[model samples]
Target: MGKILITPRGYAKYGDEAGKRLEELGYELNVNRSGLPLSREQFVESAKEATGIIVGVDECDEALLKQCKDLKAIVKFGVGVDNIDLDAAKALDISVGRCVGTNSNAVAEYTIGLMFAASRHIVAAGCDVRSGGWKKPTGVELYGKTVGIIGFGNIGKHVARIANGIGMKVLVYDVFDIKQEDLDTYNAKSTNVEDIIVNSDFITLHVPLNDETKNMISTKEFRQMKKSACVINAARGGVVDEKALYEALKNGDIFASASDVFTSEPPERTDWVNELIAMDNFILTPHIGSRSEESEINTVNKATDIMIELLENHD
Candidate 1:
């Protein structure tokens, strides 16, 4: 049996590369081809005998973590470690690590694209024009506007560079450290959340979704934004309250919004999902910001590296 039973769809977009990496590691690796995420029972059964797992940002919750007696380490594919039950991992001595800088540029680029798609009504306009509606929409421009970034990490910095390239001023606010040199290099301004909310023409969230950031942008924050301002969330879900965002856009408090992540995965007939789909001002992607070819390779390498490090030395 393979010492590692990688959860299915570990690299849904690039399976061949993942296979090669595991082959080179000289350890048994199983490919997950279930066409869906492993069911919890399936997860428990499959991983019960494994020494390590390379996981995505799916749920690695308490009940799921408890079944893995042989699990020595978990290597996350991307930056967000929220899926893993960290407290449980710590208690079980399961070392966890993620790919940090690997996919930042990809996500940054996607966020900017989402901004254009939303501002210009790209999707809506294309469909309209194809259907014989000659409404050449007047879209907002990025030049001479402020772009607010919630987090000042790798992804946030890259977003600053891209947004600045389009002549957009960058403003950042983080509870964590924001270096002055980085601010100077990017010609970005660093301040509190209020300044970002009030001044930004476009607000793009790059922060992790944790206790402090959960629902950080809500009705009150939305009310603070300019009537013409909009928001983009390419980071983790739950960083902004979906209900509040819906209300903000629905009530015309803000111009528009877009998000790659949602509070629920495969959302089942929720009010928020319904509202967003109904609104032409909203753009939603099924969490594909970091699944580019290069990023997938980077994430797989990071996950495999973690597994190799633990399996050969620690275990």
Candidate 2:
């Protein structure tokens, strides 16, 4: 029975059912109790002897993976693996897996919430009321507005369903071809990125972070967007350049924007994130896209099952 490193703080916070199950199956649990992502040194030291790892947002770069001599597998608690070095994992003969679709609905629902919060200035209005001021903010209606979706995956499809229910006109784009049936199902139109960028009333991103998608929306895309448009990034952070986003919001290139993900987690006080946090037109959440009770149970259980299978049933 080898050790399994559980590095997500959320896992520990969600109670110890997964850990208890692992223990009953005779696998040693090395759980992170720090209530936050482990520092790099702490992560490497703990994972060096682990047979498998259940990770969240913690980075598992090539250099870090090479030091884990006893590591056999890395199973992501969520779908994204941008923090993990897949090439290095392959070279090291390590198996990698993810809890796919476990958080799709949760994240999709969150994206919609962010859209309403940004479009209507809900958060800002609440803050003003808390501070003993009464100010009504003018907002746009979502009904009958064109919403551009940048990716057409599970989460993207879920978003489209919700948007359609709200009477929104949906325009979708993806690197791969979107089936005509899916377009018909959602009453969406298949379009290119430029059409979405320039013409959409609301633009939402749902792509992963990779070489091809990094900074996919930057200064030029921001400049091309309608002055009344609102941008939403419930997906990855690197897909939109932070510096350019800061400038866009400051100059009112877009009416408002919101994001649940950032280039850095727990962004430093000295970072541009702090500036964005101060703006009434910019809404930032602490990466809580998939934090619903249902999603947490599904993702943690799936991740634990994968770890057990990899460690106990591997040939």
Best by TM-score: 2
Q: Candidate 2, TM-score vs. the true structure?
A: 0.95
Q: What is the lDDT of residue 84 in candidate 2?
A: 94
Tens digit per residue, CA lDDT, model 1, 267-312 = 5667767977678788878899986888877777777777777666
Candidate 2 lDDT, 1-315, residue by residue in tens: 788999987788773888888899887898898886788888889889898999988889999999998899999999999989999999998889999899999999999999999999999999999999899999999999999999999999999999999999999999999999999998999999999999999999999999899999999999999999999999987888978999999998989999998887766677576888899999989899999999998888899888878776554
Who wins the lDDT comparison?
Answer: 2
How do all models score by TM-score?
A: 0.93, 0.95
Clashing pairs in 1: none
The segments of candidate 1 whose C-alpha lies over 4 angstroms from its true place after superposition are: 8-26, 130-132, 313-315
* Worst 10 contiguous positions by lDDT, candidate 1: 1-10
